[model samples]
Each structure stands twice: as C-alpha cells, then as structure tokens.
Target: MRIFLIVALLLSVSFVAGCSRRADDRAPGGRVIVSYWEKWTGFELDAMQRVADDFNRSQDRIEVRILPVSQIDVKLMLATAGGNPPDLAGLWTFSVPDFAEKGALTPIDAALQRAGIGRERFIPVFWDLCSHRGFQWAIPVAPAALALHYNRALFREAGLDPDRPPRSLAELESMNEKLTLVELTRTGRVVRLPYAQLTPAEQRSHAFMIVRAGHLPQEPGWWLDLMGVWFGGSLFDGRRITADAPGNLAAFQWFRDITAKYGIENLRNYGATGGNFASPQNPFLSGRVAMELQGPWMHNFIGKYAPDLDWGVAPFPAADPAAGKDTTLVESDVLVIPRGARHPAEAFAFLAYLCQREPAEKLALGQRKFTALRETSPSFFAAHPNPHIREFVRLASSPNAHAAPRLCIWRECQEELRVAAGNALWGMATPEAALAQVQERVAWRWDRMQARWERVAEARRKEWLDRELP
Candidate 1:
C-alpha cells in the first residue's frame, strides 16, 4: 500500500508540474508569480487569500497565487523530489524535521536575516519550531498553546469555587472526583462517568503530564517530549538512543496506575457517547463532561453552538505546581519555501510580509488563533474573539513553553507510544513490559533511520569527490 501511494504521488506531481509550467508561461505582466500551496479550507482559506490579496496590492514586482491543497505534506514531498515544487507552503510544525532531513526544503535563515526578522520577534517556542538540527527551515504564522477549559456552572454545582482552579495534580484529581457523577442501571452496572470520559487527544495530554511528573531521565531518546521537558528530560542525547531510561519506565507505570484507578471500561463507555467535537453535542458543550483541555479554537465552537454556556479558561495544572507553573505545549502551522521553487526570493518576501505584526494579527484573528509574535498591540487583545486570548498569549511567551519532540520520526514514535499506552490501559500488558516493547521497537527504528541518512551522506560525498577528481 505504501509503495502504491508513493508511485501515485510521483505521477500526480509530474502531471501538476506540466500544468504549472504552462500556467507560468501565460502569467500576466511578467511579474514573478509565486505559487503557494496551503492546507486551509473554507473560512481559513478566505483569511489567507485576504492576506495574499493585500500583499499583491502592496507591491507590483511579485504576485502570490494561493492554491489550497489536501494532503499538502505528501504532495510537497512528491513535487520537490520531481524538481518542481510550490514556491511556498504552509505545513504543520511537526513536518519540518522530516522535510528538512529529506532535502525537500530550503533553510530560511539567510532569508530571515535579510528581512531583519530576528528570533526575538517571535514567541520562543514558536521560533524554535522553524529550525531543526541547527538549520531554520520555516516560520510560524499561527501558533496555539494548550489550556484547561472548565465549565463554571459545573464547578459551582460540585461545591467548588468557580474562580480558583486546581493548582497541582492532587487538586485537579480532587476536583475531577467532585465534578464526576456516577449513574447506574437497574442492574447496578455503571452508565456514565464524566471525569474519565475524555477524547483520545485529551488523554494523550494527560499522559504527557504524568510522565513529566515522574522525573523521567533527561537523556532518553524517547518520542514524548511534551511530557519529557517537565522532568528536565530531552528526547535525544546527540545521536544516541536512550529509550529505556529509568525515568521513562517510572512514567509509564504512573500512567498505568492512573488508568487502572479510573476503570478503563467505564472510561470507554463514557467516551463512546461523545459526539462530533465541533458540534453542539460536544461533550463539554452538552454538559456531559465538565472540563476539557483545548485551544482557543474551542471558543469559536462554544460561541457558535452554546452561547449561554458558562466557562472559564485557566493554565493547565502541573503534577508539581512549583516545577511546571506556566509551562505549555506550543504547536503551529508554519510557512516554508520548497527546494525546487522557481521564485524563492519573491516567495520569501511574501513570507516576511505575513510575519509582520499587522498581517500576523489579522490572520490569527481570522482563524481565532494566537499570533506567533512575542508582542502584540493592546487593540489585538481587546478585539480578539477569544476572551481567554490574554491567558493563551501569556502561556505562549512563558519561559517554559516548548514545542513537541523535534525529530524526523516523531509521528512514528507517537504511534508506538499510543500502542504501548493502549496495551497498558487495557491490562493486556504490564506498564513496564509495554514500555519495554516501545523502547525496543523505537530504538530499532531510530537506528535504521540513522543508518539510511548516513548512507545517503556517504553516497553524496563519494559522488562529489569522483566528479571533482575526474
């Protein structure tokens, strides 16, 4: 199946390139036409087009033609390999490492320096997302930070103060217990349990914090860096793999214990009741669940579907309050110039314009997303759709904010961790045993990837030497 997909991708790229070449020859005004592929749809697409239209009107030397594409990352890879890629693309931050290592992307350091866009202008975590292995590959446009969103009405119902959120793991757990209600059938079987009923995304976020609190070892080359940083751990120690570090084992065990305490079956039953996340029937909106971990986008859903819902947003509590205060996981959609772009300089010019304060804020507000910039004007905060925008911006600029594990195999590693977590949660394997399997599998994959890259480097070196000496 993978091979078939690869072949299909290459064929599509060839076809598209032919079409693009013809289109370029007929473009108006002899202006440098930069083709940009983005992954946004509907309103988001409109927002981006507004920015593009403004950029075009601002200068006549260059024109950015925005094209919305599905599965953009795959298409990007195929196009770049075929030697005909988009002038610029908007990609998930996690895709940077893979694209950079594959030689499909152009480093943006020189372009950024020429534009006088210093790293200090960006939120620290968002700025870090642009680089991999010491090379800047992309620039962040819309960044997000995770926070705890709780129903104020639920808090009052549980006899808890609506204003004071949990400050530590113990407090959060206690609040969860109080907010949770158990309903039973006539046969005494459990029917509903609110606290344990979380989406997979929420569950993963919780797992990350648990692992971090367990004091996981710093040098382990594990996949779960969002959790690792809290414990002062990194996913890699140079090129060495440390998947089976002592801290990771402890973290997995902790996760297993928490899962067991909640009763997996009950959690599963409650989770099955959830409706579409963006719909009116959403667990949080419908009052089926009292609390959730979500981004600012949730506000849009709430306002659209349940305007009367009383909710408050607060910083996600840490396992240890003193250690994890203000720490956040930052994610973003980034812009990059592909390797074979015909208008690299002009493409970068548009990128630089988008990164400016006004355009950045405009796009962010359009999507209800936070700006990647470190500072914003007072008007931005006041007019933002999200009432909690200030809190999110604060977290974005926090000293401890971090991006996810920046590795080429991050997606693969995340899948492995999910499987291991499932095994432990279902009691099919002991936490220690499940994590042991993860360590073995991930280490092997990492080693294999390293070998492949090394071989590529060697082949390139030999080819250069032979050509020069001959």
Candidate 2:
C-alpha cells in the first residue's frame, strides 16, 4: 500500500507540471509595449482610447497604452528636454516644425514609404505643415478650418432670410449695420455692436484669415507676408527680406479702416457682454452678435448648448469674390514619436493606423470631435448631425484648405499682430501705423534670420568647394 501511494503522488505532480508547460507555450509573447501621450481630455481622451483599444485587440505584437496629458505642448517640451519622452505623443501641427527643428522627433519617411502611404492620401496643406526643414516629423490626425457662423434669429429680426446668407464682406457689413442697436439704459446709451466680442487673439486670427483671402490692404504693415500678398508687396527678391512695397501699406490702411470706420466693436467692451468664445452664452450663440468667425467646435457647441438656435456656416468672406474660393485655414493635432522612445517603431505603427481615414472617423465619432481626414464614413456624420456640420465636414476635407505659416518665428509674429490689431481697434494707433509696426518688426527679425541662414549656407558651400578643389 505504501509503494502504491508514492507512485500515485509522483504521477499527479508530473501531470500538473506538463499542463503548466502547455499553457505557457500557448501564451502570446514578444509584445512591444508603447507608452503614448496626448492632450485630449474628457471626450477627446475617450475617442483616442477607443482607437488604442481597437489597435491592441487587432494584434498581440504591439500593446499601446494611451496616457492622458493635458497641456501637451509644455509637457512634450519638458519631456523631450529632460531626455525621457514617451514612445508616441499627439502634438499640435504648428509645434511639429519646432520639435523637428530641435531634434526632438524621429523622421517617419521610411515607415510611410513602407506602408505605401504618401502625401496624396492627406490634405496637402496639413501634410505640408507637418513637413518642415525637409523632414516629416509628425502625422496629422484631425484638421479644423475657420468659417463664418451667423445667427438665424438675428437675420430674421433684421428682415433678411436666414437660409440665404451673405456671400460677400460688403453684404456682411451691410447686415452688421442693420443689426447694430444703441440700447438706452438709465445711466446713458450703450453701444450694442452686432459683430462684437472677438478677443485680440481672435481679431488677429481673423486678420490672418482675411489676408489669406486677399481682402485686407497690401504692403509691409503688421504681417507683410499676409499684407504683402494682399497688397502685392514683395518681401524678398526670392532670397532676402524686402519691406518696401505698396501692398504692405495698403494692408495696413485696410486694417485700420475695418476696425475704426466700420462698426467693428472694441475687443474689451465686447467681452463684458457675453461669456468666453467657447461658452453657451457666447456672443454668437446668445444672439448678442449676429455673426462670428469660429472653428468646427462651434458645431458641437450648437448641438449641445443651443440646439434651438438657427445658424449657418460658410467660409470667411473673400476680399475679391472672384479670386477667393471658400478657403479654410487648416490646423491639426499630430501624433509624434519622441527621441529616446522605448518603442519607436511600434509607436509609429499606431500613428499610421490613426491616420487611416476610416479608423480616424470611428474615433472622431466616438469622441464627438470633428474629423480631419479626407474620407470619413457616412455614419460619423449621421450620428452627430447639426445644421451646418456637414458643411464644415465638407470644408475640412476640401483641397483649398491652407495651413498657417510654420516658421519658428510665428509665435512672436502672432503676439505682435494681436497687440497691433487691438491697438487699431481701440484707436490707439491707426490701422496703417499699427500694422506698419508689425511689418517693421517682422522685417527686422526676418533679415536677422536670413543672414544666419545665408552664413550657414555659405560655410557649407565653402566646405564643398574646398573638398572638390582639392
């Protein structure tokens, strides 16, 4: 009996060990875990997580862990500078150039080529924005463009058809004049400007939009490149900065006239009348203002905040009706592979998947954020249908959409332009003078940058010359 018991115990132990080994053999192995960071919080975060979840379940080789990091730009800068970046991160399109220039990113040309995805699959402007200094540092995931948002109630009150919106700036100005009212309070009469409440940042952004449309005067005022093109000023002889141009001067003059002579409201007083631009009680939403220049987010705002309000979305009015074709200014959120990444190749694989139009739409649909890709699934729009959402979706994917300048100096230039636009609106400086200062500053900075580039090029040329001569 004792011998039989010992044999039984040994057989049980051997059977258990064999089963454990078989289980281990069936387990999926060699997973490259990628740590990802993004700015999206709340709904945006949820959408991104859905994509990550899908990718994780699709295959076992790569496991993507999506980390939510608000204030993404500051976080990315600190992380990269500290030499400890995540495997993948979502960055703003503008910051791509800045990050790439500083060597904080790895180029994805080979990955893109390997995947058989080229520039043609994406919006040209957004693709160009990601390409800086001859390298592709990031991939655009979502794109937004500016458009005109008008209150239908205001249009009806002013004796106009809400469905038939303004096709020209002159018509819009006319509508604004009709909508303007002077409210007589007990103390005194207060001005109720129709198209008021735009911040200095918004105003300058609007000016940039207008300049792109070629309506603002041309020459070297404020941002001469914008004014230069509008005013027909030549900033460079195809090589160096040239500030002297009639186009620049005209742009400056136009800037001043639009703020002062026209019924354009002051940025300060306008803010008091309504909540912030994103709020439900925003000037445009609350009927305090008849029209506004806003992005695709407004679609969500209207659906969630003021569903009953009638509104129309159209492109920013062109300077020359014939010349300007419904152009949208494209901005985007990008996914990047940071330097020192633990799993860069895996990170890039996820990024490439994110850029795929169908999966991107699924994510956008889940989050309620707008789509950036050219081809979105029909169900995405069907699920979140606002009045002008389809129009925005159409514009977002359109070929005419353009990206704002990606030059490193763009931040400073934007700040200066904002200040100048405010000064012009408040009558602190004539539009022409205010814009002139901006142009002057840009010229000085541009010249300095050009000189530095020239010297670097000259040194490279000399090195090559010497090598060849020897």
Candidate 3:
C-alpha cells in the first residue's frame, strides 16, 4: 500500500510537470491547435505522429499536436477532474465505461455522425467497445485479436502433424500431453516440462475463447460474464447482482478442473524459469514452450528474433468440435474526446481524418497492429509484417468476436478475479469460495458506484434545470 501511494504520487507529480508546459491554444499560423494526449512512445509515438502529420497536411483549419505520456489513465483522470483535459486522448478500451460514467468523456455519437462515420465503418466488436451503457464514448484506433501460435518444429518432434492444429479441447489436451516432455533424473525428480504456460493476458484470451465456445456460462459480472453467456446466466438481471449464480459456480469448477490437470505448481515453476518474454530466449521462441495463445504482435518478435523458426497461427481451438470455429477475443486502443475540451469539433475532425482507410492502414502498418477499419486495401495485406495478418483480420471481422466486459468497475473486477483465480490455482481457496468472494466484493463496489452515479446525475439535472429556468 505504501508502494502504491508512492507510485501514485510520482505519477501525479509527473503529470503536473508535463502539463505545465502546455501547447499553444492556437498555432502561429492561426490554426486551431488540438492537443492530443496519447499513451504511446518510441515507435508507436512516431506512427501516431505520422497520422497526425497527414491530417495536418490534408487541412489548413486545424493543427493536431500529439503529446505522449506515461501512466496515461492516471494523468487523463487527473486532467479531466482538474477541468484541463486535452482535446483528444488515446485510451484503453476498458476505460470507456468508467470515463463515461464519471462524465469525463464527451459522447462521440453526435461527433461521429457529424463526421460522417458510422458503426459500419469499424470492426463490429471494436465499435461495440467504444460504447458504454447506451452512448458511444470512443473510436477504435488499433485493434488486436487473439489466436493460437504453435511451433511447427515442436509439433514434428512430438510426432504430431504440424499442419493439423488442434480443433477441439480434447485434441488440444492430447497435443499438450504429447508435446510436453517430462524429464526425470535417476533419483526420480522432474527435470524439465515443456508445454503451454499462459500469461495473465493469454489466460484471459483462453477464458474468453472457452466462453465463446459455449463450454462455460456467461454472467453480466465481468469476472464470470463469459461463463454466464455460455450457461444462459445473467450476473445482473438489470436490478441486482447474481454473482453466485449456479452457472457461475459450474464455470468456476471447470476452471478448477483445468488448472488441476495442467498442474498449477508445474505452471508456476515453468513461468519462474522461463526466459525474458521480450528476448530471443523467450520460451515460445526458444522451443521451451510448444504452443501459445497470442496476438499478431508476436509475429514481429518471431520475425526479428527467430527468423528460422517455423511456426503456424490458427484460431484458438474450441471446447467442443460442435462449437463455432472462428470465435476470438478482440481488444483495441481507442481515442476519446474528453469533456471540457477547448475544441471538440476540431479534435474530432482530426480523429475522423485518422479513421480514414488510408491513414488507419498506415497507422496500423507502422505499429504492426491490426487495422480497426472493417476493410483494407490488398496492398495492406501484401505488405503487412505479419504473414498471418489475414487470419487475424478475419477473426476481427467475425460475428463471433467479443470484447472485454464493459463495466465501470471492470479494472477492479478483473484484478479481483485474477487474485481469486490465482488462489484457486494454488489450492489456497476452493474455486467456489474464490468466486463467491469476488462476486460479493465486486457487487458491493458496483452498488456504491451506481449510487454515486445517481447522485451525480441528479446534481446535473438540477443544475441544468436552474440554468434553464434562470
């Protein structure tokens, strides 16, 4: 807790220091200067800058100045609360609900319509991510979808067909067993175990895939939403919390079963021993891990560090063969217009320009990200760094694609869920106990947030009424 406070203080100080040197409200050329705060740096910053430059060149009315910042969520929230926000901000998709609910964001539905952009213009799931409750709060900039990446060499070594990736959970388990080599010393102590070990992000992707495959239930609560959807359960039937729904319990049990089979201790040990993920010695790249669920960005790492490594990308396998084949988890970075911006219209103009097919493609190509735009030129596919770009693009556009849960307390819920999941995996808590605790804690938080929201709404209503009457 002390560490968290210190980090928070540092972030606040950094944000204040950064904001002290504000950009001119108007450029020397008498153009409206739109301040754009983005959480991108280095190469990603350069890519966005290029897009900004293109927008500037395309018009003389507005000049978009991009500023990259660290701890963007913290800075953005502080700026909004201080009533000195940038005209536009690039934020994570999960921020939509909180920002919108807090009245920090300007709904973009009107702006989008004014700019002649429609829901049809973006990948559906990406578009949905921009909305919270009933209003559109952001625009997708760079989207990523999850897929299964397998080392072809490892498959061949296991005497498995390299071309035939697992199509069902059973097959995936079988392949995992065959691919995982357990070496034992003369004393019968285990030496090495090589298979799939997912990071937190990868686990989320896997959970979503299982939910999409109809193997688990999905509930309205972010933690168990996937399972609730699968089991026709609703975490909130619009009036109250239902975190301990029967389906959610069943889902937790399934999670426990999978963790037990995978051997939680083995996974923990393997992860501890794995090489740096950003380096060439990464388990997946070093052939220490046979398979992984990852995004298109993994292609960049493989191409740069392991050029000779033969690999294959496929849709994450379903829990059952009868489940749909193309389901995937989609996530994206989004641009939002914060409330109290000095130039909302001009900021949106720049945003709309960036959303154009050409500019969007250029940005995606520069960042090695999948384009958020629904359609792309053939040239984009041909020149994309990822050879399997089409596969990701297809998944992005698939009707079955789903985004992370949209809730004002999504971040907190996710954190609690992770803690519970870890505890369950380690046998510190039964899956049932962990999930019940999460449901209760998150539901309590949600109730408080909702009450605060209602108060804020009432205050706003009264303020507007007073203004109109006066």
Candidate 4:
C-alpha cells in the first residue's frame, strides 16, 4: 500500500525532486537494499559510507546504500507523509521530537529491547538525545559537546598565562577586554590602539572601530538561543515555557553588556571584517578573535585551515561556575527508520550493528568524533585525530550537560529566542522587554500545541510503545 502511494506520487515528486526513491526489496545480488538517506557530504558522508560498507560486509542479507541527500529533513518529512520514506535517515537529534510529533517515525522501543540495545549501552546524554516524550525514536551515531576553544598564542600575546583559561564568566569578560584591540582607521588607512587608550568621546565615535575582539557573543553563535543553558535556565521546564526565566534574562543581559562594552557600531564594523567560518580567514583562525565556544569538530577545520594555531580546549566559563560546573551543550547525529520504510527490520539490523562497540568506535574515529558509548577503548584515544577528544567526551558526561529540549515546537521556540537574542544583543530592546515579548508569544504557541497533543496523547502513547520492527 505504501509503495503504491509512492508510485502514485512519483511522477510529480520526480518531476520536482528528480524522483529520489527508496531502494527496492532486493539488490542485483539478491540482498535486501536498505536505502539510507543522509545529509552529510564531503568527508563526513564518507565516514558513514565506510561504516555502511563494514555492515554490508558483515552480512549477506542486507546491502545498506548510503545516499547523500540535500535538505534531508524537509525531503524526509515529505516522503514519509507521501508514504515513501527511505529505510533509514541521518538527522540531528533535535529533530526527533518534531518528526515523532508528525507521526513520521517508527518508535523502536520493542526492537531495542529485542536487540538488547538500552540506555546502558550508550552514554546517558546521547541516549536521551534520541528519545522524545516516552519513546526512543532513534539511535545516536556520533555525539558532540561545546567547550571554550581559545588561542593560547593570543593569551601569550596579551600577557596572560597560556596554560590558564578563564574560570568564570567574569574572568572571561576581563580577559576579553584585555585581549581586544581598537583601530582608528579613516579612508581605509590604518592605526591600531588598545581599547583602553581611546578617550571616552572616541569610544563612542564611529571613526574608532574594533580591529580585533577577544569574543563577540554572536560570532559563530550557533547556539545563541541555548545560551541560557550555560546561564542556568532552560527554554522549557517540561510543562511551561521558560523564556523569561531569570537565568535567561541574565543570559541576554550578558549579551547586551558585552555588546555595550564594545561599542555597537564598533562591533558592527568588526562584523563586517569577519571572514568565512570554514576558511583560514575565520576570525578565530586568523587570530583576530581570541576565544570561542566550539566543539571537537573544530579541530578538523583547524587542521585544514590553521595547522600552526596554538589552541586549548576547556569547559566554557559559566555565569556561576560553581553551580554550573561542567555545563555544556550536548548534541548528536542520529539514525532513524522513517515511517513506511520498505525494509524496517533489515535497516534496523544495520543500525543495531553500528551501535556495537567496534563499529561505533570505528564510525566515531573516522568522523574524528567520540562514540556515544560510555566506555571508549584505550586505542580510540591513542589513534584519535583530535588530541582533545577526551575533553569533549568528559563534557558530554557532565551532570549539567544538556541536549535541546524535546518539544515538538522547539524550532519555533528556538527562532523566537534567536530573535530575542538579536534584539537584546544589538541594543534594539532591553533584555527584559525582548524576552518578555518572546515569553508571551511562545507560551501561546506552546499551549495550543500542548492542547492538540493532549487530545491525541493517549493514542500516541499506545502506538509508540507497541510498535516493533515491522
């Protein structure tokens, strides 16, 4: 029935999408073809392919073909809605809730139990990332956690000890000021001055610009919305929206204060000088910015762009370092069997295989990442590409480590917070006012969504718990 529905829509979907299709039941060699759609490209994609090759070699029953697909989330949702989703897909763990809410995923609670896959097999944080509501929707393939990536060379240049990183946000802020350099350039000619040397009048003048910054809260600010995680607030408390929580207010105020410390116009001009994040011209790589919150994958880019960079990784300072000790943002890449898949059992067989100690370690190694499993082989660190991989692994296992909240409307809430952050950070509005508005709007949306979910909650719980690999 699902295949018939897919064929019915093929002409139009194909006309629009080049008709990307799921694999048939059998390959040329008569093995099951598990169509695994993925979003990774370049070396990252190659890593997953090698894992798939290993799985294929390990079994004669299934041939897992990993296909690189663009806009995979959008295409995946559509394909599942149209009843033709691939056997498996690679998605960010945050997407699990949204997909599950749409009835586009197969909950694998029974399959997991049958295969002896459980929370004990993986790090608790990675396991949690793949779960939504009361069901396990996916399995983590690779995990990541954010940390303070600082240039030791910049520290030495600023007369700070290279071995020591800021222990508190206040310390970080002080060091940021010391490392910052202001420029008084007119007509594109050059004059460099320390920010301290600028007169009060000059500080506010458009003529004076930030030539180098120690940190800009918005630079490479991928998790600006989740900044509250470090500040001891969360967007949701499982029942109500917490956008205007005191910690979140402080989080945004920190943004406002940071922006004010460096003049807004100066920071704006500094932004203009920013270069591509992946290239050598990246402010951090170029040594114009001294510190950033980044993950282990940064080492790969560092090697590709700035091999000589003297850098160190440590837990990013928190507002209250003692209370928020070891706090970090945990994120992961996950694999899922989309609803209406052609080969659910065989596809999951491949997923289960990858979750094993050996293959999980191999995939993580190939991607220059650490595995979701808690106990890593000693050789994993010995042969690891990044020398600081263990630090990331430690961060992920911290008591305060958090993944995105499992809300069906998280993307909407995230965008609202992003807008609020911009408004407060850029001085468009006071942090309190900006966040109050966000709270009002997102709460209304969340209430409506919760009401709808409440109506279907019972049925979903029954279905999600009872479904197995069909």
Q: Pick the candidate with the highest lDDT.
A: 4
- The true-versus-predicted C-alpha distance at residue 33 of model 1, in Å, is 1.6
lDDT comparing candidate 1 with the true structure = 0.73
Tens-digit per-residue lDDT, 267-302, candidate 2: 234434556656786556666666776677777777
Q: TM per model?
A: 0.83, 0.76, 0.82, 0.93
Which pairs clash in model 1? 218-233
Candidate 3, residues 327-348: lDDT per residue as tens digits? 6777899998887788888888
TM-score of 3: 0.82
RMSD per model, one decimal: 8.7, 11.8, 9.2, 4.6
Stronger candidate by lDDT (1 vs 4): 4
Whole-model lDDT per candidate: 0.73, 0.64, 0.73, 0.88
TM-score of 2: 0.76
Task: Give the per-residue Cα lDDT of candidate 4 at 290.
Answer: 93
Off by over 4 Å in 2: 1-30, 184-255, 262-268, 397-400, 450-470
> Which pairs of residues have clashing backbones in candidate 4?
14-19
Candidate 1 local lDDT, 1-470, one digit each (tens): 99999999999999987766735522588778889999999878898899899999998899888899999988888888878898899999988988887777777776678779978998878888878766788899988887778888888977889999888657876787667665433245544443345445544443221101111111111223345444443455657555456545555555566566555555556556657877887777877677666778889889989999999988867665787787666789999888767777888899899889999999988888879998898899888988899999898888777666677887787787777756765677896787778778878888998988787966643432332200
